[model samples]
Target: MSGNTKIDVSYVAELARLELAPEEKVKLQEDMEEILGYIELLEKLDVKDIVPTAHAAPLRNIWREDKAGTPPGKDIMLENAPGLIDDELIKVPQVLPGEGMS
Candidate 1:
């Protein structure tokens, strides 16, 4: 690819939601040229037998074995609550005004 490839810096800034200053526009144009030059250099690499991949390692969920265990009772769970309670449940403020039974 030719290093002569042109980039519309102002148009790209609009699409990317950027409010670049006048000096930033000049800097961005030069930086974009360097970035495109790097891509042009990468095009010369040979990868005939190399497989394409999204990452360097395989993607999979790594999880521990699911084992049953004892859990604290409700009385113990509510011991640290800093709010009001009714029976065995903790009480909290209403999410929306005039929406709950109160």
Candidate 2:
């Protein structure tokens, strides 16, 4: 991209659903040109021999068979609760008016 070429910042902003001021549009146009300039520089790089990779580092899924685990007993869980009712149920603050536990 040539520095002399113009970028339609207003059109780009409209596509992005942005309502940019005149000064903002001017700034955005300059910023966009700089970014495109960088892209142009990148296009000149030689990478024919380099292998394309999805990530910079190799990755693998550490998979294992899904298995059901035993749930903690009611008594064991109740012991950890800050507030309890009937020595079994965990008590929590009401989330909605007239909508607490029956």
Candidate 3:
């Protein structure tokens, strides 16, 4: 990928269903060229010994078996809340009380 070679910015934008302004098109062209140049540089690096991995970090399933159990209802959750009215909704304490401030 020669940096001197022109990247088809308009063609790429058309394929991606984009309507880039004149300034935007110029910026995108420059950006794409830089990106391609970086890729070319990476191609020159020695990666024969490096194993192919989906992620840079080791992926592990830190999960447990899903056990079938009865989940608590909304009513049960409201009962544990600080303020519980006759209505099903949980009433929370006011963030600021008028009595406290001058």
lDDT of 2 by residue, 1-102 (tens): 455666789997889899999999888888988888777776567788988888877788897889888999878867878988788777788878896576
- Per-residue C-alpha lDDT of model 3 across residues 1-102, encoded as one tens digit per residue: 455767799998899999999999999888988888877886677888988888888878787788888889888777778776675867766668666432
For candidate 1, which ten residues in a row score worst on lDDT?
82-91
Higher-ranked by lDDT: 1 or 2: 1
- Best-fitting candidate, scored by lDDT: 1
The root-mean-square deviation over C-alpha atoms between each candidate and the true structure, in angstroms, is 9.8, 11.0, 14.5
Candidate 1 stretches with Cα past 4 Å from truth are 47-50, 61-102
lDDT of 1 by residue, 1-102 (tens): 676769879999999999999999999999998888788986688878988887887779789789988898878888888775575667777877786776
lDDT of 1: 0.84
lDDT of each: 0.84, 0.82, 0.80
lDDT of residue 98 for candidate 1: 86
Off by over 4 Å in 2: 1-7, 14-17, 62-102
- Of models 1 and 2, which has the larger TM-score? 1
After TM-score superposition, the amount by which residue 48's alpha carbon in candidate 2 deviates from its true location, in angstroms, is 2.7
Per-residue error (Å), model 3, residue 2: 5.5
